[model samples]
Target: MTGKIVWAAWHPRHGFEIPHFYDGAVAFADIDDAVRLVRTLNADDKTNNRNGWRAVKTILVRAP
Candidate 1:
């Protein structure tokens, strides 16, 4: 069974944005988990003052 692939972006002083051009992303078997991660990252960034951003998107890939 194949799992779903999610894409997210992290930027300075940004919350969430399009995954395009972003090489960094987080993946999860469940969409809920992916969302949770985004929220977690956002909250973590707030305290760390790293000025980070986090976003999530689902991507479709064809099997080779």
Candidate 2:
């Protein structure tokens, strides 16, 4: 753990029960790991598919 309580990331709208793939239901412990996951997820996704089959779709959201 980073030992610093911080922000959390989850897909409630997408129906994610708990945080998957990342360390926990929290922001990445390290910047590198977060970046890696982003790249991997993008690679796994197909064009125009977004969160399609075989793609682990996790989104980064900003307050609206």
Candidate 3:
């Protein structure tokens, strides 16, 4: 089985655009676990600061 590539966008403090690609199976056994894993792996500088933009909200899913 091959993992898919997931794309996500992030808006930083300087209004800069940031995009990320995550390759993995989104079909986790549990939604909570999937979310947690995504959150951890997706952890970035922009999402760290309270003043900066929060975590990724819109994720572009790609099928492989």
Candidate 4:
């Protein structure tokens, strides 16, 4: 099955929010793969310290 992944970023203290999309949503063959990618991106963002923006959550949606 195919799915779409959605992610967002937010600050810890300020409560500022940033919505992110990956070139019209990312398509994955398996939901597990999509979750793995989310974890990887989150980890990378923390490691890289991308302007204090870190991946806060991921949503998985089955393609229609």
Candidate 5:
């Protein structure tokens, strides 16, 4: 079935500007799971002094 895919996008950034980082988008079947991961990742980044952003995104996909 074609449906919306949930993804957790983590933005790793420097304090001043957007810093480039080799990041991978993680897909989740549920929005709750994606949000959970985003929170966990952003919290970890904060604790490690890695200032960045994280969000839950959705994309429509076609099922073959």
Candidate 6:
């Protein structure tokens, strides 16, 4: 199974990391991976990060 990334944080406090949250969704293979990515991203001091997002949804993909 392919894992996906997700970001639910929509507050301005999220800062530049907001886009990363959304980008990760649908890119991870499982929750664990997604959580890991979230943790890593959240660790950044420049932006607020979280383990999940309220707008959790699959990202758009296109065929080659």
1-64: candidate 5 lDDT, tens digit per residue? 5567665554555322223333444566776775665566567666322345555466647656
Task: Point out the higher-scoring one by TM-score: 2 or 3.
Answer: 2
TM-score of each: 0.40, 0.34, 0.28, 0.34, 0.47, 0.38
Give residue 30's lDDT in candidate 1 (0 to 100): 65
- Superposed by TM-score, candidate 2 places the C-alpha of residue 35 at a distance from the truth, in angstroms, of 0.4
Per-residue lDDT of 1-64 in model 2, one digit per residue for the tens? Answer: 1245322322324332233454434355455564454455445543222342122334345545
The 0-to-1 C-alpha lDDT of every candidate, in the order given, reads 0.52, 0.39, 0.40, 0.47, 0.53, 0.43
Worst 10 residues of 5 by lDDT: 14-23
Q: What are the per-model C-alpha RMSD values against the true structure?
A: 7.3, 9.1, 8.2, 7.8, 6.7, 6.9
Task: Rank candidates by lDDT, best first.
Answer: 5, 1, 4, 6, 3, 2
lDDT of 1 at 62: 53
lDDT of 1 by residue, 1-64 (tens): 4645655444554444424434444455566675566666657556332445444465645556
The numbered model that scores best in lDDT is 5
Give the worst 10-residue stretch by lDDT in candidate 1: 13-22
Per-residue CA lDDT of candidate 3, range 1-64, in tens?
Answer: 4444332323344332433434422343344554554465447543443444333333344546
lDDT of 4 at 42: 55
Stronger candidate by TM-score (1 vs 6): 1
Question: What lDDT would candidate 6 get against the real structure?
Answer: 0.43
Residue 51's lDDT within candidate 6 is 38
- What candidate 4 gets wrong by more than 4 Å, as runs, is 1-24, 47-64
TM-score top scorer: 5
Off by over 4 Å in 5: 1-3, 12-23, 47-51, 60-64
Q: List the residue pairs that clash in candidate 1.
A: 13-51
